[model samples]
Target: MLRWTVSSTDSFLIGYNDLDNEDNWVEADGTQHSYSRWRSSEPNGGVLENAVMMYARDADDWIDVNVESSRQFICKADIGASAIPQPTVNPSCSNGWESNGGSCYYFSSDQKTYSQAQTQCKSMDSDLITIDSEAEWNYTLGYIRYRYYTRDYWVGLTDIGVEGTWVWENGGKEPTGTYHWLAGAPDNSGGSEHCARLDRYNGYQDASCDGAIYYICEDDLYISDAPRSIQTTIQSTTSAVITWTTPLQMDSQNADLIGYKFYYWIRNKQSETTQSVTISSPDTFELVFDSLSPGTTYEFYMTGYNSYGEGVASDPPGNFTTVSAQLRSENYALNIYRIAKGVYLQSHVIFSTEAITLQHCTNICTGVLSCQSVNFHHKATTRAKTCEINEGTRESYSSDVVSDSDYIYAGL
Candidate 1:
């Protein structure tokens, strides 16, 4: 049987008759499998006529063969898989490295300094490997399994060539996620080159880019990515939160995932209403978003990424709804008093307590028409915490407000 990594993109050529289009290839025994096309002409015999037959265009006289004729046929992949060859930059001087994020990197640790390494990576729309998360740290550790203490591999994270500012080949200068250090690394040692890397044993380390170390590069793709594992919880009349996971990391040329991009929708007329949200930096498997409209049904899902490209979104996503305020927690001290005519919500902070941020207030004012107008004590660490929700239509205060020492908002 022939092996194939069928991209969902090029399946049209194979026709709808292909069995792979139906579901994940798994047998009753739970053995996963993939499909390969047999030579058209070969599968041409038998009353079932299941033997491969030559494609009409390529067959010419072969098409005249009797339906029962037995002829050896050659296989040709109708899918674009056999189309153009991927362009390679240094196919001769460089070797390929398979990244945990599902990408390919090419590095020549034989080079002496960083300049050459940058040049090589640049030639291929990529740069030296830059580690970002613990997942990535583990991914890199396995990639260099063949190489010993030998030398430090070159990563794209650096400030030396630019000084004071560090930028990765990933288009942004700021570091995302958590930063790690191998106790005392990126020291520039004697002040030469300062490239960052994840140590296999522990922490991050800096090395000269030109120091003869194998490296990795990245690729990125944002188009055609779908959302996955969607879950929705509708709380009250004005808001909801959507959560999901991705199939492959975004922009991954290869390596563990870095972050994700989310897109959501609500059925509109005969179509779905669409919107996008980017969670710039997050770990694998989870995300929480609250601030959707009340009583509106929404579908949410996400796609993953690393430094290179994005993969497809998940299938069989879930749906959710936003309930009414009547469905909210009456346990919020059941404070149902009139702020002005609009009847607003206010959580009493009994003491100067925990620190709070605007995100907390925005979350509280779920489904508000204007979340931007809310005022929150972003750094409040005491009972001073307060978020003034702008209801637009307010009435004079007619009742005493209840106290909520926690002053927290509800999402469900």
Candidate 2:
């Protein structure tokens, strides 16, 4: 939510202007001021989810506000808003790039080859644009719409010169963050033009730079680097699993998560520290550090990353208890059985000692958290024989479940 304050300045623009500590300021043009008086709710400009709005702070329930509503808002106190510091904005101010408050941007039109269009943008003193955040993207969208281009234009990004090697004309190349591919498109058709274009989708696709496509210009925020998040788990005292989610609003929408790195430390029986563990991946993850010294403690957390940057690591989530394992939380019952190494739970056996069946085995495994694979012992002929439980072979599928009518085993 946007926070507004009546500035000490006596000018009529008083409350509309917002000042940054570095002296950079974003003045709210009468948009909010006029709307606040008549609109039922505060306005919201967030790109993804719509912001919640209420007429008054003391209101019991909040309501959805229009993008144009005006309301005295509260900013998140803990995170606080980041100020965009003033910098040498794109100097070719007169070029196609639009400068709203201070930054500059180039709108695009699909036309010309990649090299040729870049040369054109350079003539304007700006290279192709690199968008990093949703704010920048929102600004670009409006800026592009404001341009008088008849069609989409090529921007600074493309993979035409080298197949599969996408790079910016302004810098060393590689794609960052997750991407949306145009539907059945960007085949680099005919292999003649490798230029790219940015369309309404906020997605990019290769096109003939000279194709007269519309473009976007940019004056960037000097964000040094986004924080990185790292996660680790330890099956220590009580087999604690610690997961830390970062505080940054990264690709929270489409998720640009590269993977999580985990760190864990355990103590030996002598009270000495064990080797720390590190793990990484580009997907949801789970790690268990088993065989911990009972009654010991462990610490761990998770961090996220993409090509653009990594988010801050969450604070350590820790667990203590080396031996006591609690099962059956959330109303789920758990069953742990001692099994023979190499023998799988090929099938399920009834308490009455009936033959094993596939339906029963899968159900049993699904009910238990520790179980990953399941097998039913269907071949056993003895209805009185009790099924055997054993460790499953790691690399191969489960073989036949042991079943023999001759063996009359007793059930517990």
Candidate 3:
């Protein structure tokens, strides 16, 4: 993989040298120097040509050039012990994350404010997508056009901290490639447009932070082998909620996972079903399975799918039994209400930091699964504001440990 060339004014030393007083040459490795192919009058001692060199244009011609003169050189290697094989894993991306060139990207279907989108991406262990290469930029533009149909996406480039000083999400300087900026771009139009997005024209355009738009998240491809550590949390007579840790991919692997394949079957039954759900964002990892017989046990496993292929399936399927039909009832609240000064119902369905209002938390929880109770900890001027949706009535959590007295502890 390497080539060596000596300077024209100086010669490079090889392993061969005249070791004996009689001008008998020998190599550094003690090999007999039996080969000779000198050029016409190459060994002219008056020129002090003690070292040797091969003719640059000929394959076999040799010349006794100056020891310090520069010329082409060749190297040889002997086979050594067998090299140790490196460990390799089937690289893949997590559900909802697309793989591309040593990275996992997630384009959010749910739109959010610029700050909210950045927070959401960070919650999923990623940052706003950065377009560092022409290929990456073109691919992003094409993908956005195909999926969003002329819609815009928030890119990581911004000059908010210092006007006209654009920087990437990872604190890198401006990209060296093409900016693809639209005409009159970063015009500082209104003097408030600091954030940037990939516009429909495949150009980088500055926009206001308040504009709600789908964003992109990028992280290293180091997810696990598959969706593992699955657990069946809550189950009714006909439905069950399953949660699992997200799948992981290796750093050197490329995975373009779009979603997950949920596999389930009734224990000891011949029938089975496989359902696939597209994750709207990288933050989603739970799914609810419905329409099951009462008091029946079911086993389930999951696998992630991407453009490359399907990843390894879960090792052991999670098992859960639904309650009896008589034991199921809809006796929970569907709205957010104040439970106590510093207490909240346990058995939460999901948690979110962007849920700013009680209604927002209620709507998010009620749409997913059976929402019994909900809590909204709204504290302005702080990032700790959150929404917690309670599905089961197990116990209550102390509000002091979660929120302050000014927090809005609502339950439903």
Q: Rate the local accuracy (lDDT) of all candidates.
A: 0.46, 0.42, 0.62
TM-score per prediction, in order, is 0.33, 0.30, 0.32
Number of colliding residue pairs in model 2? 70
Range of the 10 consecutive residues with the lowest summed lDDT in candidate 1: 12-21
The C-alpha RMSD of each candidate to the native structure, in angstroms, is: 19.6, 19.7, 21.9
Say which prediction, candidate 1 or candidate 3, comes out ahead on lDDT: 3
On residues 265-371, what C-alpha lDDT tens digit does candidate 1 reach at each position? 77552254677766666544444444556566766555665455565555544567666443346664244322222222243221121125645554455434332
* Candidate 1, residue 323: how far the Cα is off, in Å: 16
lDDT of 2 by residue, 1-412 (tens): 1114343321111132211111112223223333233133332222221334433323233333222334456432236656656655455355544565334665554455556666665565456675545565556554443333124556666775677677665444645344534565566677755666766444566665556554554433221122233344432233344444332323221144555555455523324553444445554444555445554555444445444344444454443445443334453433332223234334432121122454444333333234444333445564422333223322333354444433322111
How far off is residue 171 in model 3, in Å? Answer: 1.6
What is the C-alpha local distance difference test score of candidate 3?
A: 0.62
Please give, for residues 126-170, the per-residue lDDT of candidate 3 as tens digits.
Answer: 778877677787667545533553468898888989998888865
Taking the candidates one at a time, how many backbone clashes does each contain?
Answer: 59, 70, 13
Q: Any idea what lDDT model 2 has?
A: 0.42
Best candidate according to lDDT:
3
Cα deviation in Å at residue 117, candidate 1? 1.3
Candidate 2 weakest lDDT stretch, 10 residues = 16-25
* Ranked candidates (TM-score, high to low): 1, 3, 2
lDDT of 3 at 178: 44
